[model samples]
Target: MKKLLILILLLPLLFVGRQVYSDDCDTSSVSNLNESQVKEMIGKCQKNWEMIVNAKKPHEESLRQMEKQLAAFQARLNTIASDLKQKEIKINEGDALLGKQEEILAHRVRQFYIKSFYNTPLLLIFSENKSNVEDVVRVLAYQQATTNDDKKTIIKIALYIKNLEDKKKQLETEKNQLSSLQTNVSEQAGKVKKLLTEANAYQVKLEGQISQLSARQEQLLAEKYAGSNYPMSVGETEPSRPVDDRTIDPGFRPAFDFFTFGYPHRVGMSQFGAFGRAKAGQNAETILKAYYNNVRIEKRDNLMGNINVNGYGSKSFEDEYLKGIGEVPSIWAEKGGYEALKVQAIAARSYAVSYTNNGQGSICTTQECQVYIGHNKGGDWERAVNDTRGVVIVSNDTNEVIKAWYASTAGGYTRTSADVWGRSTPFTKRLADLDGAGKAYEGPSYGDSPWFYVAWGSRSEYGNSAWLKSEEVADITNALMLYKADGGTLIHLSQPDKSNGDTWSSDRVKEELRNRGKNPYNSVSDVDTSSWRNGNGITSTVIIHGDAGDNTFDGGDYKYVFNIRAPANVHLKTALYNVEKK
Candidate 1:
């Protein structure tokens, strides 16, 4: 019985030990693992990552509460300090008054003694003047009465001084105790913050491990299924055409088309929007000012120095580094987009200077930073670079060079750094890329970006079909329902066609949906989309009418499920999207 009790007590500890061991994702052995083993590892890592993420919130809240408490304690300590200073002043004033009173009492005593020595009662009685004797007696009685009052005043003042000293001592003791408490609370807050930071670092480590494992899994799958057409994920600048519903025969009378607003992260200056604005007769300054709010174009001639470019070491900042930038098409400069090219040059220059911290650091030659193609791009690009000489975008508030983040397209709206990356910057603003009439100029007549309002899919893998069938659409809704009902492995909800392994079959998904008290649909009859603009624009709500019933989903949730469950060939690239029913 004792053994049984001991085992019961140890059960929780054993379980915790196993959990900790599982959470330690050692990717060093991933290379030797099979496809199934890698996928299983990914699942475990993802689960652990979620657990860490959820656990971070409480610690963060506790830290915030402790900080508030610390502030309150500081304010209270200040008040007590101020009170002590005032009490000390009063005590000094009382001491000075008591000294003055003591001097007056001593002088009065000397006067009384002198009068008694000179006008003795024996001489008054021997003299023949009775009135003189009575006057002397009255004067002596008055002097004695005044002396008694002075003694009472001295005693009262002494008692008051003693009380003040006692109160001051009490305040000092209280102050010391409070200071100690504040220190302990501050230490606790520091500990909480450290734990939160460690958790964040652990989360990053887990994510890295998962990324490595996923890469291995992808490699293993690619090796296993050689010669099979596996669709590639969409790139930022992949040339794509808009889905024309009139041409696509989806093998059904009624079909739906999903149109995405933007291609990539919709933050900072829109390159295509800049081109469009420049074409609209706006100068380079105006184009830049429109994208980045409250900024000034400043010329910093002193920034002329050498910048270390990876692979191509130590290039001239003004001439060599700026010329090698191949961000925009050089041909655009010749075709009435010279202002846009100049904007790109200035933006690129500013980004380089800020990123390198005035030539103290090194920048890479990839889109991860700014694309730096070695050697001068020459032609109009060279002219654009020279035109913007030493000009860079500076934040008016900070008076420092802005990062000048620019993307290929922002669809129509741009988001702040805080909205996208959880870090706020002073210069970036969320603004609509609209014209005088408050309409986006990134459509057919303006920016003319192919990624604008296009269905996402790699054409090579889908047999040139980017459109979804009715049943496939229904499967997406089913996946979303199951996800909302029971939070499980996200990849399990992925479409069977694109899933490498460990995905729920269509039948199993529908069964799970039904088990969770959700109505699973066979085919989507009709779909409706609603959108409202915010930091992350459009596609706010979606309502789907299926054979089983109608279901409504939040747009962001729908986008998440769509990206996960949709085929690799076709996925929603951004959250801002619309659905059309025909």
Candidate 2:
């Protein structure tokens, strides 16, 4: 019997040993992960860092070139302006010279006309006739000859004057053309100078950003050592926002609160669960590649809400929508209608909330909160987030989500502002040699110093909430007003409900809703709404310890207790159980 006892004791010790050994990690899968993996990962991260820093390299060089070109262009412009001024003066002098030439031409033409009219006529009259004729006939012939000679001289002089005027007009046209060319060149030079000035300013801004990134990278590296090992878990609780059984009128559609429970952005599939656990220094790209050929573009609809919608006439719930029921009219409970929000509340209570603190935080616009400013690819995610401007309703009975009333974060209204950090301490991203603890002093490997430290900076691992835009408040308030317009109970999850940490509840939440203009309401019991109790007050849900079934109460372990299987992509860390056994 003593030997039997020793064996029994040894069995427990063996089990414990196995558990401890499991903690050492499974290195067999990564046989080649000596120091090589670490170097490769760090190298990739460093490269990405460099790309961001060097985004301005070309611009900086362009700015320098611009400065050089600008100065040269300016000098050329100045010289052109001076030469243009001198040319303009010379043009004026040429005009004066041309005017003098025109005057001389006019005087010569006048003299020729005058000489032709007087001397030529007289010469012709005298030479021609007195000897040639009968008195009347001879006189007439001489007169005609004289007249012809005079007309010929006048015609010649007029032609000469016309040629001189044509020459003068051509000279004026050439001068105007030269002035226009000078003006165009001057305009182009001015444009280049303006562009150069803007480019220099842009380069300076980019340099500042590079400095900030360098400092921030160092801070990130420092936080690597302080990382947490455990994943976050959700606690058990009765649904705070319970569905009403009597409240099930026809044509009810339970509006699922989207912002809080909508599927979270997926992290890349991990060969190891978390990024830190993967090969150190390896970036997400390399690690992801090594595990799978490449990151597959998985359809997001593959991960739908985790709930059994049998009342809606479907055996299983698919992606956030109801099939077959769409054909049914609003009057039918089986089709276009939902079980009063109360009946649906029970199934949801069995469902778990997300691992993060569901949208409760100090929302802000500063880099502290990493507000999604509608500019990048990630901007699309902003549409679905609640920016802390509205209210959310939960069932008092089970604490499952009932509704999330969101405000528009469109305008300039703000609810709050704060930063989320990766570490408690601040550091720079220096490329220096790291100590045993990976602490940095300084070097090429080291980046510039950071401005601030955020405790929960990485949403990839730690998870994140949204920043409420000031503009969203009225829309959020109006939506909440609609829920309050009818009758709805508001349950707050952040406030502690019971003495133990097992649950969280708040009367203040209901009051807040009422203040927001919701109708007056009363609290109901979870036992009446949930499968918490049978006829004898003997519980059917989980019981962990001794008699009254109160030790650690959880729902049953029956896989399909609610006549449903767990949904795909559902994350259940804490097991639920039935309290049937002692």
Top-scoring candidate (lDDT): 1
Among the numbered candidates, top TM-score falls to 1
Per-prediction TM-score, please? 0.66, 0.21
Model 2 regions more than 4 Å off: 1-97, 110-114, 117-120, 128-494, 497-582
* Cα-based lDDT for every prediction: 0.75, 0.27
The count of residue-pair clashes in candidate 2 stands at 61
What is the Å distance of residue 208 in model 1 from its true position? 5.4
Counted clashes in each candidate structure: 0, 61
Candidate 2 lDDT, 1-582, residue by residue in tens: 234224223421101111111212222323233222322333343343334334434444444544554454455556556655655665566556656655655665565566556555456566657553345345455555655655555555455545545544554454454344445434544554454444445434434433444344334323331332111110011111212212322221221110111001111111111112121343322322322221221112222233223222222222222121111112212221122111111112111121113322122222222111222211111111111111122333334342211111101111111111111111111111222454221111221111001111112211221111111211222222333343232121111311223211234434555577543223211111123223211123432221112222223222111111111111111111111100
Worst 10 residues of 1 by lDDT: 12-21
Candidate 1 lDDT over 260-372, as tens digits, reads 77657777888878888888889999998988979999888878489999999999987898998878887776567789889999999999988989899999988768888
